[model samples]
Target: MGRSSLLKRIFALNVAAFVLAGLVLAFTPATVSAEIARLEAAVLVLVLAATAAIDFLLLRRALAPLRRLSGLMETVEPLHPGQRLPEEDSSPEEIRRLAVAFNGMLARLEEERRRSVERSLGAQEAERLRVAQELHDGIGQSLTALMLQIDRAARRVPQENPLQGELCGAREAARTLLGEVREVATRLRPEALDDLGLANALEALCARVGDQSGIPVRLSVDPGLPPLSPEAELVVFRIAQEALSNTLRHADASAAELTLAVGDDGTVTLRAADDGRGLGDSVPGAGIQGMHERALLLGGTCQLRTLPAGGTEVALRLRTAEVVA
Candidate 1:
């Protein structure tokens, strides 16, 4: 037979207790006169109080598990999944079924969220690639040609002509514009990642960030690390990029370090640390959340923590199989 509902169980137990009390009173020889003595009134009040205490105890025992479940539900975090209520055999049947149903619902929600994040990040990466390619191939090439034309014109102009200086200046301006365009393109999508592989790309990224931000960014990579798929590499690079960006903008640090290594259990780990003022009470901003989402997309974990001694660290761990696959 299906288990009874919680309300029905509670109501039946309470009614049975009350009925038993009534039967006991009916069978007892003691009788209360219409004008009762003080002793009789006192005894009646004590009986009612005892009955109320018993009822209260029974109600608390029956609803304790539900209260616990409600507290846990309040603490559930969407991004961090896998929390579930205990489904012990000793628990009430109603509570056990409710726990199972709630756990299943959480599992489904997490799966749906994972798929949504996958689609959103996938589209974002595709758009970045497209824009980077256009900048490099279309506008980039046009600027190159323009610079060449300007240089040729400068060469043909007589050295004594005042107009020759203007041509040189124009050529220099075109060159600078071309450099800026390439920089922007690289930022959108690093070509080094596609051509040189993760290790070199990461090293180049650190060097570039250090140069631009005036902070010393040290890098360490394990030479024996296994190869990673392009998507995994992109995720790692993006997380590192964001972490370093945060360090530069908010950390107020003088130096930073980025390390990539493979664990003995074949997990890939990336860590970025800076010796700066730690994140005190500040909440994580969009950049930090993006890092977390990227890691989740790759079936990895990302953590941001403040060091005991000083500064902040962003650590990411990914199963090697997930990255390689």
Candidate 2:
């Protein structure tokens, strides 16, 4: 029975016992009846007090498991998936059943999360590849041919001719367009990341952002860090790209820093910090949310917070083994 219903029934029994004692006393001789009535009233009071104390203890015991379950939930992590609540042999039957169902639900959720991340990452990479290829083969080659033709036509024109100036201008414009095309291609997908490694790719990224934004960027990476799976590498690279982009666009800072460190226990830490205006109760943008989702998909943690002094910091941590492809 529910604890409340049981308590109500016990209270009713107490009331009935008091009523019966009063009725019995009413039929007895006058003096004796008064004395007996007083004794029964005292007994009734003691019984009610005892029952209230018992009810409180019963309720506390029945609810203790839920309290423990809540505490365990607070510590659960997506990174370390599939952990189950403990079902002790001594636990109440209801609590054991609850724990079993909770564990099953967690398992299903983790599985769905895995599938969703894989699908998302696959689609993202495929789209990037397509865009990069089109930029490189279509627009890139067309612009190159145009630049060559413009150069040839400019050469054929007389140096003193008025048309020479316009031809030269046309060639310059084509060259600028070609440069932009190459930049777009690179941003779509960094070939260096696939050919070289994370370090070289990140170094190039830092240099490009600094040169373009006129904001100095410093990069520090651990030399002895173990190599990560390709999927994990991509996730880290993309997150760093987004962080730097946000810094350049919104930070309004003169400098930024990126750090990649590997711990002895195989945990990889990535941090991006900038000296600029702080977040200050503002909501995160889509780019930041995307970075966070990507990290979670790979069983990693991403945190963005304002520094105590000023500016903002983006931090990510994940164990290498947890992100195996």
Which candidate number would show the highest TM-score if scored against the true structure? 1
Local distance difference test, candidate 1: 0.87
List, residue by residue over 1-325, the lDDT tens digit for candidate 2.
Answer: 4323334544665565556556544664423444567866666566557655655665666667778987987888775675789976566566667778888889899889888977987898899989998999999999999989988888898999999999888989988998998999999998889999888899999999999999999999998677878888888898899999999989898899999998888889899999999788888878987887888877788999999979889998888787544
The residue-by-residue lDDT of candidate 1 on 1-325, one tens digit each, is: 3555678778976996687667655776545679997876776677667777888888887799899988988898876766777776666788888889999998898888888988998998899999999999999999999999988888888999999989988988989999999988998898899999988999889998999999999999998888899889999999998899899889989899999999899999999999999889999888888888888887788999999979999999999989984
In the predicted model 1, the residue pairs found to clash are none
Highest lDDT model number: 1
TM-score of 2: 0.79
Each candidate structure's TM-score, on Cα atoms with residue i matched to residue i, is 0.89, 0.79
lDDT of 1 at 161: 97
